[model samples]
Target: MKAIKSFSIGLIFFVVSSCGSLNPINPLSLLMGNSWALSSLMGKSLDLSQFADGVPSLNFLEGGKLAGFTGCNNLSGSFALEGSSIRLDPGAVTRKACPGTGEQDFLGALSKVGNLKIGKDKLTFLNGEEELMSFIPKED
Candidate 1:
């Protein structure tokens, strides 16, 4: 029957179209709602004892909000993402009379971050092609 044949064709078209509508995994999903702890700075491993706090860490929140600890003062900022590129704007930092210049170094490096890459177990921030900092997922 013509009606049966037309129905079959329509069903096939619907199935094909539904498959096409499925979107690929979004990279933002990997970055949002995740926390990363500072692991290495400028290719050098950090000595946690140097920090008064346990370790510097970052938490990426919804709506581009950023919160972290700089090993001395609390860090707050806003971040924007475009594809794999990122821009972090450092905001208010508590005056805690940090002993060394490590906090300053961390914030300074943060300001220069131009992009980011998320790997299997690492998140890396880079300025162009040079890696500025790297982080590991904060254990919950």
Candidate 2:
């Protein structure tokens, strides 16, 4: 009886310790697994799957960095997260001109995001009470 109790306690400890900080249950893991493409911008709907080129996408990299394509430019920036709040700083972006690309507007909306809401297959960036950008997980 004594040995069984010890083994049970040891098993529980091992299970709990294995789930430490890097567990898949962490929200960041769920957010990072998919690169998200813009579904809408400032209430204007867009379907990125239909676009032949210049499809904007967003990725949340590890180590508090955000990197993605801005339809025409590659952008990388630091992101601040506090509890449920988030802010994606407008970082460096290549300035090569791509006429008719919505790079500026896309980056603009990202900079304004004050929080992020993750749904089943969508990511919504919000500024205060307004939805600034909407995205759906992009296919691998």
TM-score of each: 0.79, 0.73
At residue 50, what lDDT does model 1 achieve? 68
> Could you tell me the TM-score of candidate 1?
0.79
User: Tens digit of lDDT per residue, candidate 2, span 101-127?
Assistant: 366677778878898777668788899
CA RMSD, predictions in order? 4.7, 5.5
Q: After superposition, how far is residue 37 of candidate 1 from its true place, in Å?
A: 0.4
Give the Å shift of residue 109 in candidate 1. 0.5
lDDT of 1 by residue, 1-140 (tens): 99999999999999999998997656567776468899988778987766777789888888888889999899788899998899988688888887776787789899999999886578999999998999998998
Q: What is the C-alpha lDDT of each candidate?
A: 0.85, 0.78
Per-residue lDDT value at 112 in model 2: 85
Q: Candidate 2 local accuracy as lDDT?
A: 0.78
Candidate 1 has an lDDT of: 0.85
Q: Lowest summed-lDDT stretch of 10 residues in model 1?
A: 25-34
Those runs of model 1 whose alpha carbons end farther than 4 Å from true positions after fitting are 1-25
